[model samples]
Target: MTTVTLSGVGAAMPQPGDAPSSLEWLIYQSATAALVDAGLTRAELDGVVIAASDQVDGRAISSMLTSGPAGAYLNEEINVASSPAHALVTAYLQILSGTHERLLVSSWGKASETAGGSIQAAERLSVEPFYERDGGLSALAATALQASAHRAAAPDRARAEAAAAAVAARNHADGMTPADVLASPLVAWPLRALECPRETDAAFSIVVERSGRAGSEGISLDGAGWCTDSGRVAERDLVGLPHLARAAADAYERAGVRDAAAEVGDWQLHDYSPDAELLAYAPLGLCAPEEALELALAGAQPVNRGGGSLRGEAPFGGPLRKVVDAVSQLRAGAGVERAVAQIAGGFAGQFQTVLVIGRQA
Candidate 1:
């Protein structure tokens, strides 16, 4: 098979306390960081793929904001205002399809500038208008509802919740406490402030190269894949996701992983909402439906090792940040022999993307 390699990677967010830069400025910073990481310049870029959330950008077409800054140089350019992993999937397909070899993937979000309810405004209107938007349901409420259903299936709420909190506290950049999680105030029935993704303004960039070439650091983008599920929350089973299962299965197959729970090294699973992380456990084959807590307590696997979006609080940029973290883990020798990164979105349990990167060819 024709393989792809990630040659460079970089991330940039607005300087804290500084006047937030324009969307274009964010794009420039991300692109610049990635090019520098790859040891390439704007003069070498021939393709640009951007991922974002239109709602976060408060713009109809978020890519319109990045055109000039992305260094497309009048070459092929594409943008998907979805998850950054989704964008990476799209870019990977383009490269394998022979449209482009050198791909630049970037994502940005500035939730700080907007109303920042995160619940009422962060989801998809096209898919879950009634339950997610029309009913004024926030992501926390939806996740709480799903969590409630999940807990019913398993009966160990405190342990699972604690395990989730431990994962968050350990991997996060700031290393928040379980007490901080406990006292953060409830968002839904059982979901607390600490259990949710912290909203922040951030941007990320990555360069995936085709095989037979290497980045400045000799890193490679071996394999990656992203997948999704149905939208309507009412029609699907809320307690679990078959879609992410399919995604993980496919990504594992492509990456030549036989037993994910045994073979994988570190992981950067999306934990945007604690409920989502709990649900993801079973689907990704990381653990059984209710065994997540026991496995978590044992510390068998270091999930959300980079702290995930929960600690970073950058929603739209979370997936790319996760991918960047996965790349770092692989390059830094922090994972098993391999690592996997997963990202998901959409309302009512829909849309998921999983990427598995390994050290071997």
Candidate 2:
């Protein structure tokens, strides 16, 4: 199988607002910039994978609207129709299958296009209509459930609060003061706005090519996996993300990774909420659940380097944004040689994607 390397990455981020540029325009800008970064022209890209969701985009068959802007006009193109991180794995498979030499992958989300209440409704709709939806499950409420579960499963609440607060404090998008984080209004019981990822208008792209022909400084998708679960939330252990844990375990096995936290130079987490990060600690092998405070409170990037997803973002673009940040960090200097990015979507991580990145081809 051919090796896949991350040859280039670019992003266009405007504060989430009623902006002037259309979503297509943002994609075009980011895609074009990525090609420039890769030192490749449109003609050199053999295929394209664009990620977006109709529900989020507020239109069906949204790819029909984005292909031209993404530079996939008259070329091979497919829509992951999910998180951009999933698009990366799909692009890697296309390369490994020897079906494409180079691919351009892009993803974006314009939260400003939809009303705040509407976005919340869309999130609630993600749950199963017959079961979970009727019980009232929004992303925020689901995360709150996970937070409560984590605390209940722990030996004591103080340790859980400390670890979770550490993730919130260190990764706050605007560097929100600790007092500000505490003062942030609660959207759901035990779930404050400060503990959640902010919505934004953003478009990001990356160029991936077969290793030997790709540039020397490029990072490669060493291993990855996507997982889904329907184990029924009511009976599930909300404190742990089993689907993500399984995905990480599968990716690690392929990458030959034994000690994930110790081996990785940097980590990029979806951290849908503060407790989500603490919940993922033991699963990702970052540290024991009880020891989360030790790493999280230590410093910036305790585990999530690039300030994680708390900084720049696109609502559904969390996973891909993580990858984009990792690429920037890897190319910047030495010391940080390997990284991982994790993204989950749905009620308490119904679907998950994990990617293991390394400097070597």
Candidate maximizing lDDT: 2
- Report the lDDT tens digits of candidate 2 across residue range 314-349: 667545778887777777756887888787876777
CA lDDT scores, all candidates in order: 0.72, 0.78
TM-score of each: 0.91, 0.93
lDDT of 2: 0.78
10 residues in a row with least lDDT, candidate 1: 118-127
Residue 151 CA error for candidate 1 (Å)?
2.1
lDDT of 1 by residue, 1-361 (tens): 8676777788776656888687777778888988888878776766888886677777777676675687776877787766777788888888788767787888877766675474255553553555555675555566677766766666766776777666556555485776677778887766677776667777788887676654443555455656666655666677778888888888878777778888877788877666677678888878787677777666557687757777655656656787788778888885456777887776634678878776654
Q: Which candidate leads in TM-score?
A: 2
Worst 10 residues of 2 by lDDT: 297-306
Candidate 1 matches the true fold with a TM-score of 0.91
